[model samples]
Target: MVSEERRVTLREVARVAGVSVSAVSYALRGAANIPAETAARVRAVADKLGYRPNARVGELMAHIRQARPLAKAEPLALVYLEGDRATAKKNGFAQIVEASARLHAAHRGYRLDAFWLSEVEGNARRLAGILTARGISGVLFAPTVGEKRIELDWPWADFAVAVAGMSELSVALPRAGHHHYEAMREVLRRMSAKGARRPAAMIEATTNERAHRGWQAAWLAYGPAGAARRLWLYRAGEKNELAAWLQRLKPDALVTDNANLIHAAQAAGWAEPNERGAVLSWHARSAFGGIDQGYDDIAAHAVDLVVTQLQRNERGLPDPPPMLLFPGRWRECSQTSAGGHAPSLREAMRCAL
Candidate 1:
């Protein structure tokens, strides 16, 4: 009769192969020091004994071996909210978030799934059911717009939860995003350092004031003596208003959130970055000079925060600390000055369009 211990141990195999346990381990791992004949013999014994590394044992050992406690493995969800102008801007941000989350999840052994709240139908219960069935215990809420705030059914407290963007969480959820205020301020500062004075900021009429607060604060903190004009491209209208503003403000540099403003400026023939003009992206990316604010970094951090909370068996927000704001790269629009002949933001933006 065969022994009930159908599973085999490395010790048993090593003993049968007449070798030290370390030698067996080295041979099995294909370390160069092991002789070919000896490695073959140990492998044969291991195979005959059905020796397999015990997954649970290995996991426990890994946890024990870590200087920091290992987080429990869990699956997570990223849910998107819906709103018109707000939702329109979500696409680019969503892509960056998803890309970053996917990369982190792949490395960390966590699973990430994206679900559109709008597509989930009328029953929030159904959304809850799907999560329970999938054993997903964590969530990252992307900026969502709906007729009303999403009513979630699952116990968020039983898992980790996080949100993106500048909007305050309805619940006690932790938030992570690029420091829009600091970034904008820095953009203004850099533009000034690069020779801009009396910089102007242009934005969409519907742009979030809170998200823009950093830029505003930065402006207040480091702006020139006279107030810089705030131009709304959406409201600017087709009568060359952008051009009018450009001529009127005569700003040494410009800051804007609207992609259209840049295009409009280019259309009005203000695209070139000479000694007289510059445009910087604010919490947005363009072919123009400005900050990335590390969208990818924020995405990665969001994934980690969610996973960490889940591992700790944390559910809903209980005043989670804000993540460190990662600064973005600032490239001068005129790359002709750089040692390598790199394309400027204007050329790149035009190419993207």
Candidate 2:
């Protein structure tokens, strides 16, 4: 039996490649700032030495790098479609994402800046020039309403790009957003636990499309079995039709994405916490119970993904874009008193029993 050769170290590879240890490490990871020829030489030497990186050690180093204080010089772009600000606010969508993105960017040592895609008039080349001139090589595309697909004339091959939501774009990029499917399932579970056997969902057609039909799909798959249990294209303006539908369906609990629908239900004479139960699929400050979409976590993860691409010099559309999903947190809002005293779901359930 022959003794195995000792494991090769990064320091040894650095000495053989005639470069500093840091240079060797950067070269292995294909990091920017080093000459192409020098990086190639370092890789060649590393391969010859049969050096294999330790997975655990690499993860530890990455964690340390991320925890270090951020440098203020680097900037990232938050690109939004033209005239989306007003619509986003009205729909209660963009504010939290923007605020959380800014907070996370600062924590990670990058300044987040906003830009409008409409500014360049759909000219990708012009947008590319603007970004390059500002030394910005990373961009986060905010969620767009009404637009199914966005086309940019810029050279996507030069910069790292990530989209904040599932809204389709011309270029394939990594996405970060809510776990709508899981959220719906969670609502069903909660309603069932509260003795709601005949649960139903009312969703707007456009809202369903925005979430990629996640709300409808989850309802159809996980909701109580029946054909008429799930209602789509629910319009609040049609009071008579809505009331008739409620009378026909007679669902013990209602799940919806629109706050207006709750008022409509009440107007239709549906008793709350007694005859019928109401649950919001999306979180609203005024809602009785619903899912918090975890926008802050989504924003933080999106920034981290963009920063990883920047550090690794991975630009342009990914060959196979990755997706990251965060599950919504359940919130109990029904048991609060006017004096501001609120009870947890468990406490409320115990009291009810």
Candidate 3:
């Protein structure tokens, strides 16, 4: 048998191209400074040899591309509104976001540090110091406890920032999380397809309002004319107020932010679908039918966005888009049944989109 040609290496390609190894590395990255002819030669040789750049080397070169000698390793800061250990632990949504951030950071050799602003005095100043010390390029703000927030505009002036929950924030930044409106819209459209009319919205006062808007938008888009539309706002302050509201509307299909609301509707004897004088939650969190919103995806995307800004040296938003919305799919909410409805929510939104 004929001997096979040896696989090419970067050194071999560099030798053939008559350029230093560093030049080959930089040219492949499109880094400036190398002469056009020299870069072209290196590229051509690389193509001929079928050379593959090492992934780890590429990451290092990326770091070098935006080098700031004084800056520390670009760390990620995860800031949660819940400062107390007990509350932060209890916030399931916050934990999910943290997990996603951790996974993404670990894969990239980046470090993620959780900092609770609620515990520190002069939270903005303290957070600024932390960012400065670690050369943090971005922040992920979980939902706030009451009005507490890290007003670190001074420190994050050149950094990337994103929020995980609640769109209403003092600082303008990009955001990624559950696309509440779209999710609710998909759920409502699916219910409407099943011949359910007179849909009503029961949303928690604290649940993202964007979700409520989605239900309303989808309902108006597909709900039959003359159908009743009731919006009952859940309040923790008032006891039994929610139950009274549900009793009064008695909608055929009730869309709630959670299963808790669905259970409440059942307690009031609204245990059937629209056709049977019962109300079903617009979307189920159960495996049968629901919207997952992929909180992990949202968290990972936020980290990516921050890292990108840091790498590009882009900073300052005359006013950052106050809100960034990522549309989510209903399918991620479940793997199986999707409630076994004749037409799935995904199938219904196929036309809506």
Error of model 2, residue 58, in angstroms:
13
| Candidate number with the higher TM-score (2 or 3) | 2
Q: Evaluate model 1: give its lDDT.
A: 0.61
Candidate 2 Cα errors over 4 Å, as ranges: 1-73, 84-92, 227-229, 235-240, 274-283, 335-353
User: Candidate 1 on 1-353: residue-level lDDT in tens?
Assistant: 12337766677888999999999889976799999999999988876775654433433555565543443445678766543335534667667777778767644446678776566764545765677688776777775422134445656555567776544444556767667666666776777777776667775543435454565666666767665444333443554567877777666666776545655665666644543233434333344565655667777777767765654444555764655565555554442435555456655554222
Task: State the weakest 10-residue window (summed lDDT) of model 1.
Answer: 275-284
TM-score of each: 0.66, 0.71, 0.65
> What lDDT would candidate 3 get against the real structure?
0.59
* Clashing residue pairs in candidate 3 (N, C-alpha, C atoms within 3 angstroms): 272-278, 288-338, 288-339
Task: Please state the error at residue 189 of candidate 3 in Å.
Answer: 1.4
Model 3 Cα lDDT, one tens digit per residue, 53-121: 433343445567767333233567887655666776786666777888877754444578888766675
The lDDT-based order of candidates, best leading, equals 2, 1, 3
Q: Which regions of candidate 1 deviate over 4 angstroms?
A: 1-73, 83-92, 144-154, 210-212, 228-240, 266-272, 275-285, 320-323, 335-353
How would you encode candidate 2's per-residue C-alpha lDDT over 1-353 as one tens digit per residue? 11136757789999999999999888987799889999999989977876665433433455467663222126788888655445655655577777888877754546788777667776657776888889888888877666366766667877777888667777678989888888888888888888888777777777777787776777788888793445656654554577878778777787777645766787897655632344444344543566767776787788777876765556777878889987677766563554555545554443212
Give the poorly placed runs of model 3, Cα more than 4 Å off: 1-70, 145-154, 208-228, 237-248, 274-288, 318-324, 331-353
Question: What pairs collide in candidate 2?
Answer: 70-109, 124-153, 124-154, 125-153
